[model samples]
Target: METAQLQREIREFAVSAGIDKIGFTTADPFLEMKNRLRRQQESGFQSGFEKGTPDERTDPSMLMDRPESIIAIAVAYPSKMDNPPKGKKGGRRGMFCRASWGQDYHDVLREKLALLESFILERCPGARLKSMVDTGELVDRAVAERAGIGWSGKNCSIITPEFGSYVYLGEMITNIPFAPDEPIEDGCGDCTLCLDICPTGALIEGGRLNAQRCIAFLTQTKGSLPEEFRTEIGNRVYGCDTCQTICPKNKGRHNRFHAAFEPEPELAKPLLTPLLSLSNREFKERFGHMSGSWRGKNPIQRNAIYALGHFREEAAVPELVRILREDARPYMRGAAAYALGKIASDEAITALGHAETAETDAEALEEIRAAIRNIEDMQKEVPK
Candidate 1:
């Protein structure tokens, strides 16, 4: 069978398989991306989670033998949840970003890619195919953009015309030289909303990002979050969607077709206090299936503590006090101490004072002292 005819059949198969968008591109090295990544690395703008060296990441041929063309696929996820849980003053809740609202996208996309690989192999015997999802060495965004899946939005997301930036992307490299699709033109004309609205200003003047300052990246780190980004982090437990949600292109584009990507409000926006007490086993049993749980419960619990502090939820003071007193993890204890200070009730202040006296970890003790100082300052500002 001819490659073009096969490509047409594959496109139909992809759409039938529930892939929202599909495009094809040559397996040529992404020279521009390589240079940009090198610059990003030099400027210390990269998120350390990125896999592979620049060369391997840019050159697709190096990843698969005789890679002649690449197939990029996008699966749209729901941008909005029906009957979303509300977070109030007393019953504060932390949010998982839209990306992590449902089951892990890695598994979802991988299943689709696996099916696509099987279809290709049956059609073309001896066809060489290597499939990859988000964790792949090659950049999904660049490949998708080059394959005409979507234009790269100013927010650094591949914005599809049909689904906006609310889509999961994956790709397959095949030895067959399928005809390539035309790349889309830039559509972000004069729209700086995503840049101006980024909580930590991670978006650069161009379409680049300073990943270190990004709240999305910081939320995944397993340590005491830097003090500066804490307030901006707000109630987000994992990932962020500020830029995507604010994009003009994404206005009114909410695709909730896939049941696999559907969110359970209780899990997506769980109460902050309950999160503080979840044992590892409980955490996995509850949230293990969600993509946001990839970094484990430590970061989520730590962020939940910060979220309670951000809201100054007085009801959470007891839980914060308990964590400050007895939590084994120093980061959790320290974060709870900070949260208690933010709450600023007499009980919270008293707990911080007690924790300060008994705290042996120097870092946690510092957090306690800082909380005490802040609370004292807050009290001083009020009229007697």
Candidate 2:
């Protein structure tokens, strides 16, 4: 069979397999991406969850032998949840990002890739193929851009004209020489809404992101969040979508075709107070299937505390007090203490006072002391 004909067949097969978009590129080193990555490293801008070394990440041949063509695929996920829950005064809710709404995307995309691999191997028994999803050695976004999947947006996401930026990307590198697709023209023009609207200013001027200041990255972290970024964390329990949500390109873009990516309202926007007391088994039973639970309950619970604080929900004070006084994990204890301080009611102040005296961990003790100081400052400001 002609390679062009085979490529056509593969494309048709991809559409049948529920892949929203597909594009092809040659096996070439991403030299420009390598330089940008180096700059990100030097400036401490990388999220640290990135998989491979710079050289390994930029070169396809390093991963697969004599890779002649690359296949990039995207699966769109729903941006809006059905009948989304609203947070109220007493029943404040924390959100999981749209990317994490449904089942773990890693599993969804990998299933498609595996089927693609099987389809190819059966047609050309000698065909050599290597496939990877987000956790792969090569960068999924860079591969997608080269394969004409979309233009890289200023918010550091690949924005497809059809699906906006709410798409999951994956790729397969093969030895067969398939025709490469043309790269898309840059469509961002002069829009900087993503940069201007980022709560933590993580988005730099030229499509670069300082991941250290990114709320999305911050929510996934296990430590007590920095005092500066705490206020900006808002009610996000896992990841953030502010940059994508504000983009003009994503206006009215909502893909709901894939059932696997449909969100359960209760899990996607869980109640904040109950999250503080979720046991390991309960956390797993409730959120284990979602991608947001990848970091386990620690980050989610910690972020929930921060979210409650962000709302200054007095209803959460008792739960925060219990966590501050009893949680074994210092980070969780510290975050709870901070949330108590943010509430700053008479009961919250009293709890903080008790925590300050009983807390033995130096770090948690500092958090308790800081909360007490903040409450004292607030009390001083009140008119006599």
Candidate 3:
């Protein structure tokens, strides 16, 4: 089969298979991305979650033998939920970012990529192909940008003209030399909104992110969240979407093209209090399907404690106190202490004092002490 004709057939098949956008690029080494990644490494800007080393990540040849072309696909997800539940005092909710709204994109995109792979194999029986979603070695955004699926935005997301930045990216590498698509022109001209509006100042200029400071990354961590980011994380239980939400390019792009990506409001924005005591089994049964639940219950529950604290929700004091006094996990107990301090009620103070006496873990005990001091300082500031 002619490569151009094969590419045309693949494009049509992709559209029919529910791929929102598709583009092709040569399987050249991503030299610029390699250099930028090296700089990020030197600066300690990378989130430890990244899958591959810079060399392995930027070179397609490293991943596949004699890669000739890369196929990039984008699936648009909903940016806005329908009649989303609102967070309130007693029933305050914590959010999972839009990317984590529905089913895991890894599963959804992999299914689509599988279909694409089978289609290619049917047409050209000897075609050697490898496909990957976000977890793959090659950078999804870089592949998407080079393939004309989108331009890499100031917020470090691929900003598609049609779907804005609300898209999940995936790619396929093949030995067949499909005609490469022209790259999209950079569209985020003079946009500083994402940088300015980031609560934790994680966005360093345009197209650069300090992942250590990023709320999205912090929310996934297993340890007690750093004190500096506690308040800035607000009510986010999973990833942060400040940069995406603040971008002008993403303003009206609520692309709900894929049904699998449509959010369940209750799951996406869950009540904060109930999350405190979920057993591992309960957590998996309730939230396992969502991408946000990948790090398991600990991080989500910890972030929930932070959200309750951020809201200063007096209603959550009892639950937070229970966790501080009784939860076996030191991190949970520590997080609960911090939340109780933020609530700073008479009941919370009494609970903290009691927990401080019984707390055995050194770190948790220190957290209890710090929380008591914080409450005392706040009380001193009150003009009686």
Candidate 4:
């Protein structure tokens, strides 16, 4: 089969298979990305969750023998939910970001990629191909940008004119020499909205990000969230979409092309109080299919406590007190202590005082003491 003809046929097959966008690029080493990654590592800007070293990540040859071309694919997801549930005082809710709205994207994209792979194999029996989604060594955004699928936006997302930035990226490196597509022009000219609107100032300049300060990364961490970011985390239970929401390019671009990406209102914006009491089995049964539940229930539950505190929901005080007094995880107990302090009612204060004496973990004990002091300071500011 002729390479160019094969590429055209693959694109046609991709459309029929539900891939929204597809492009091809030469399997050359991503030298610029390698340098940038090195800088990111040296400055400690990278999230520890990144899968590969800079060299392994940028060099496609390292992943496959004699790589000739790379195929990049994007599947657009919904940016807005239909009849979204609203959070109120007594029944406050915490939200999962739009990217985590529906099914785990890794599974959805992998299924599409598998279909594409089988199609290619049937056409050319001896073709050597390697495919990967977000977890793969090669960066999906870089591959997509080079393949003309999109341009790399200032917010570190690949922005497509058709779908905006609400798209999941995946790539395949193959030994077949498919004709490479031309790159897209940079479209985010002079736009600083995503950088300016970030609550924690995680976006450093246009294209760089300090992942340690990013709310999306913080929500996935197993330990207690740092005190500085607790208030900034707001009502987000998993991930943050401040940059994407603020981008002018994404305005009116609510791509709901895939049915699997449509959100469930109750699951996406769940009630806060009920989250704190979920057992491991219960949590899995409820949220296991969603991408946001990958870190398990602890982080989500901890963030729920922060959301309750952010709202200062007096109704949640009893639940917060219970978590502070009896939850087995020290992080959960500590997070509950902070939320109780934020509520700052007499009931919350009394619960904190009682837990302070009984708490064995030094860190959790200190949090209890600080929460007590916070309530006392607030009380002092009140006039008789």
Over the stretch 1-384, how does candidate 4's per-residue lDDT look in tens digits? 887788889999999999999999999999999998999999999999999899889999999999999999999999998899889879999999999988999999999999999999998989999999999999888999999999999999999999999999999999999989999999999889999999999989898999999999999999798899999999999999999998998999999788898999999999999999999999999999999999999999999999999999999998888888778899889999999999998899889989988999999999999899999899899998
Candidate 3 residue pairs that clash: none
Which regions of candidate 3 fall more than 4 Å away from where they truly are? none
Q: Which ten residues in a row have the lowest lDDT in candidate 3?
A: 250-259
Question: Which consecutive 10 residues in model 2 have the weakest lDDT in total?
Answer: 348-357
Better of 3 and 4 by lDDT: 4
Per residue, candidate 1 scores C-alpha lDDT tens digits across 210-329 of 999988899999989989989999999998999999998999998988999999999988988899889999999999999999989999999999999999999988888888988889
Tens-place lDDT digits, model 3, residues 11-103:
999999999999999999999999999999999999998988999999999999999999999999999999999988799999999999889
Off by over 4 Å in 1: none
Q: Global lDDT of each model? A: 0.92, 0.92, 0.93, 0.94
Q: For candidate 2, lDDT tens digit of each residue in 210-261?
A: 9999999999998888899988988999999999999999999999989999
Query: What would the TM-score be for candidate 4 when compared with the true structure?
Result: 0.99
Candidate 4 regions with alpha-carbon error over 4 angstroms:
none
RMSD of each: 0.8, 0.9, 0.8, 0.7
Sort the candidates on lDDT, descending order.
Answer: 4, 3, 1, 2
